[model samples]
Target chain A: MTAVEERAGAAGADDYEARLQAFTGVELVPQRRGSDPVNVPMIRHWVEAMGETDPVHTDDDAARATGRSGPVAPASMAQAWVMRGYAASVAPAAGHSPFDDLAELLAEGGYTSVVATDSEFTFARELVPGDEVSVSEVLESISPEKRTGLGVGRFVTTVKTYRDAAGEVVATQRWRLLRFRPPGRGPEPRALRPRPAINRDNAFWFDAAREHRLVIQRCAACGTLRHPPGPVCAACGSLEQDTVEAAGRGAVHSFVVNHHPKHPAFDYPLVVAVVELTEGTRLITNLVGIAPEEVAIGLPVVLDWLDADPELSLPVFRPVAGKGT
Target chain B: MTAALRPAPASVAVGDELPELAIPLTRTLIVATAIASRDYQDVHHDPELAVQRGSKDVFMNILTTNGLVERFVRGWAGSAAVVEAIRIRLGAPNYPGDTMVLRGSVGAVDGRRVEVAVRGENSLGVHVTGTVTVRLPGGAA
Candidate 1:
């Protein structure tokens, strides 16, 4: 079998994982000391960048008045003190480091890239200015190969123990990284539109939309039409209900253009509008077949069907060309 | 400034509302806080990497979210307040170009200990919802 195919098989995976477990309990970093003692300058930069105004982090008088001896670094900044600076981070690592060894071993198995999945910190005690700190790390665990969104990979977990000059434990971090093979850029299939929540109350509306028809729920007793199907009618407290086929006409009552935190199913700069139907009820739906800039309040619109898929359909609106309020 | 200090133990009762704080989710804020927190995850700083990893843009990291929540609570509880614990879970991501408005209400109060139910909402939806437990500076009754 080819090397790549054999490494992907069950026996090859088992053989590879055995070597990874050998590094368990091995110290990756014996004692990497902080370049500088915990000081106000670093703390100041942290709080300012975070927009944190906690007096205990930077104001000595405020901290002293509050019972602390002086300013205390924010507890969340525990990892920052021992972080390798930009210069060291970009420089090539010395050949003797075990970190390089572990990385090389992983690369041999085709796990050449990494992404952080989770980090949990439990602080034993808060650090103060002028306190010297150092850190040591050991492999906590490495999972067998598993499939993930990034690709097939294994999880490598480690425990970093932070200590003060007195060797007392100040904090501990359980960090997990997913070392995976990069999935080359390929055209992903277009996402299907989001499905609507259909139940007995609203099944008829969607069923009608599936056939390219627009229907509204109407109270049988008082004839109050509602866009959303409900159990009881609000106008006359009637349980009796029926459906009314809409005239397929409306006007935009209000609208908004969505730009961020987007879903893969929908396009960006999406135009969503609340359309007031001719029957005196409103439905919140998306506007299709038009530019977002062309949508405005009181713009006349006509009903359109978005056949999202064979099993699902949605009612979207399109602005009527040259139609005025 | 004095008025912003610790609320009197008796003065803080259940159902009190803390003023809302709106934070603009700028790209600079997202990248700087991630680095400041020593989080080198590319998804929090590199927009291209973020998209490749299934995000529209670089988003705020959890550590930064925790820090923002702590800052919001401390601003209300005053200088003497101690953040005993912060328990939060992320929902929708806080992408750059959005504004996250944090709002909280007092849930439980046992003398100096107060529990605040906090939620941060962005343009998409609820981004973070969690409870922060703090100890106001005062003798326990």
Candidate 2:
């Protein structure tokens, strides 16, 4: 089929009002396949970057010796792989959706969409590397908005599910999007928010304001640089450390774009990304001037600063221009 | 969902059920999650307009709901199993303070793919309910 037909298939029709009314609780669209798969190494980077010093992802022998099929990735870190095709666009031939696909679908359907508020799962089995999992998701339901706040429309409800490679259901994620009209606007000038930051914090090497440049507070006793600001070093358990900026370039590692914004002041098509710094340290920041589709792991990037506050310069990254999209 | 606590376990029997978890109903919690999820829609944070339509309080967001589901399930499933996929529906108004019970039933097992039925219930009735498809190690089948 043509690419336009493909994106429409992934995102659904522009005339959502009628399609929504005919919604039958579930619509299992064919997945627009991509090459990106969650490898064990990627999972390790994600877990370590999130400050989860768990050995399962880091120590291979320990994981294999544990009687597990293989190194078990953190369950919470599942979000890394489970959300790949969320906003994937059909081939360029698909054409611009009547609305921004999902946004227009919601607006046209009159469904007040919002972030997924709650979810529940039953882990029947564990997954490891070399396992090719087939993810099949379906549009469960769409709850239309029937209220407003600050003179804007508001409503929340959008649920979906994912299946594993074995055709077994691995995760079921229900997303609630609190869609609202602009606080004050004429017709429709609102925008979607970027997805929230992953559980990543409590680091000493960097801050949103200072752009630490990879400074590690030296552990007066043990000589080592800590990217993730910790009270004590893992090796010698030393409390003292030093701040240092290693090389500012690293691979893209992994990243996500937020077409559906979460904050009012935030810009749409928001890019929340994670980068593996030159010192092998990983950091999370906003990706500017690059389209989400253009983003790829292993893609090199450089640190860019933002002067939100004269005293506090926020550190963000931009795709090394000319290197790629 | 009764706001009672039970021994939290990773593995439950075919009929075993999960104790309901209740997060207090507050406009702030809704807004904090809204901000975190990058979902800036105001209806969740504004109650007056929420009341204007049909909800009791500003409704909770899908992002927060998804986050809560991720948190609740991980807490129950022992942070080990890989979450492959989940599909659910938001039934009644999940008001703050209302404890929510995530009910599950091991329906059928095929190798590692365990067919199960699960739902989220509160004092108001079934708030969010659906079936779950999971992959387990050994299957009774």
Worst 10 residues of 1 chain A by lDDT: A1-10
In model 1, the runs with Cα more than 4 Å from the true position are A1-10, A92-96, A106-115, A144-154, A180-182, A185-325, B1-21, B38-42, B49-55, B84-93, B101-135
Name every residue pair that clashes in candidate 1: none
Q: Candidate 2 regions off by >4 Å?
A: A1-325, B1-13, B18-38, B45-55, B63-79, B137-141
Q: Give the TM-score of candidate 1.
A: 0.58
Candidate 2 per-residue C-alpha lDDT over A1-325 given as tens digits, one digit per residue, 9 for 90 to 100? 3323433433443344456544434444343222345477666555433323445554666555444655775544344454333243223324543224555655653344333434544344455665444443444555554444333443333344445655666544444445554333333422323333323334333353354454534456777655556678877897666656565677788888887736764666777888887776677777766877888888888876544322334467877772433
How good is the docking of model 1, by CAPRI class? incorrect
Candidate 2's docking class is incorrect
- Model number with the top DockQ: 1
For A1-325, candidate 1 gives per-residue lDDT tens digits of 2223322453444566788988887887787788789999888878988898666788778778778899888776777788775545476544567777888898887777676555556667668998898999888888877878667778988888899999999888777778776666343334556777889898988888878789999999999998778989998999999999999899999999999979977778999899999999999999987888888899999987766555666788887774432
Q: After superposition, how far is residue A280 of candidate 2 from its true place, in Å?
A: 98
